[model samples]
Target: MTEPDGFRRAAMQWLEKRPDSRVDYSWVSSFEYEGSRIPLMDRQRGIRKPAGFEAALAIRTTFTAAGKLPPYVDAIGDDGLQRYKYRGDDPQHPENIALRNAMKMGLPIIWFVGVAPGSYEPIFPVWVVGDDPEALQFALAVDEGQRFLRPDFGLDEDTRRWAEGRTKQRLHQRVFRSQVLLAYNGRCAICKIRHAELLDAAHIVADGRPNGHPVVPNGLSLCKIHHAAFDHQLLGIRPDLTIHIRQDVLEEVDGWMLKGGIQGVHDTRLAILPRNRLEHPDEHRLEERYVEFLAAPVA
Candidate 1:
């Protein structure tokens, strides 16, 4: 699976130059190498499911690059069923010998997963681990959007059930964050922080609460610290869009993180709003959760 000399080297150079941010399919469209000859994109960018990925993958990855593997190609199987296995560089291409050497060294290879043309960076990943045949199966399990399923993971019944349950929960969290982040344009609603990976979709109503549903209106994009505070009842968002820190938490003589990051912002207006008012947090949902926040023992 060798091609032009610097193909992989140049492509990886592009990836490395990108901001140290989570790579998500929705965040970017496509990246080009050497202008346009080595382009990184799923075949088409509109398909929203795994079908889209498979379609785009035909052109997205290692085929013309070093390993000739698709963007999401499975790890080398122990069953000896691998096709397009990297067979080493063309003897005429001396530079490709280095690429071959690197492959022999077992570097961690990752592929971004999401709807493509891969114009945007990916938030989700498919990590390739040798001998872990379930890597792809488990990847699709958590990526409910991809709707990947594996009926033959070889796990016992009970273990499989537990794994499925955990995967479903992760899927919900991922979908919830994707929606809330897009709604707020990737900024925390309270702090206005814009790092996508650092933000989370904080549930307004607890997920298992009677009326709780995993809809965008029931979520808020909060930074890691704020999401933790909100979930622990140390902070709350009012129906009127004000911040509420637990009285004791506000009064406690705590460190700068507490004062500047949380308590200090109490009662201030929320910093950002979704472009569509209909996408705003549901007032009734917020009210229900706020009551519990008021009732919780002070942190």
Candidate 2:
């Protein structure tokens, strides 16, 4: 794909400023560039500059700034894929022009274009080859909540504000997400069934009201139904993390779903306990809310 001019310029400028880190060239020969395989042995001997060096780094930095960079790329492993070795002209080479173009546009080039599907192991960090000044600049700006011009990059002020706001929300989401993930051990606390796509970061205490702290102890890992129920005060968790179904809610048919099956079965079983006990919900807070939940009539 063709890269936007602004992105390309920003990417180039970033690359020009990157520090030259020593690269491992073990996988160099496995790389294919321009429909030809570069010899691994030749790459080890340092015959030439590997292809697409700038592009790979650009993609890495962009994704890292976006907070979507995969965990594997942050650290290298024993696998050949992470070794930073490749041939100069192999078509499958990491340092290819196509890969570089994808990175400049903020696409998932490493996984989408470079790595094979389902290849789950550590991979090299995207910025290992080149410096990513553009990504670093953007991350710093966002972190500081400062406004800056990246006219070439095309991220306008309104867009930047929106992204910055989302990033803040994501920070909150992550704390809750981690608490929930640990409490449920990556499963739904109410369901006991593990499905990543169906899981949610449910606040044990509601968000942004007089009572909400929006912290780890105030969150739970719930499936969609349970999360909604908790949010609407249709359900509550005891200070012990046990499920608490509002008495009046038991009368409705939909309440039956909450009172029976997976939800019902989970009642009183301390919602999947967190491995770290310190992260557990505060008893006083849960007790206070539990009292409120009990006093209110079920809708």
lDDT string for model 1 (84-159, tens) is 2221223223222222223234222223433222223232222211222223211222232223233334545565
Tens-place lDDT digits, model 2, residues 39-106? 22222222122243343322221111111333323222211111222224353544444343443544
**Candidate 1: lDDT over CA atoms?**
0.54
Global lDDT of each candidate: 0.54, 0.44
lDDT of 2 at 120: 13
TM-scores for every predicted model: 0.53, 0.46
What C-alpha lDDT, on a 0 to 100 scale, does residue 157 get in candidate 1? 55
Error of 1 at 215 (Å): 3.8
lDDT: which candidate is best?
1
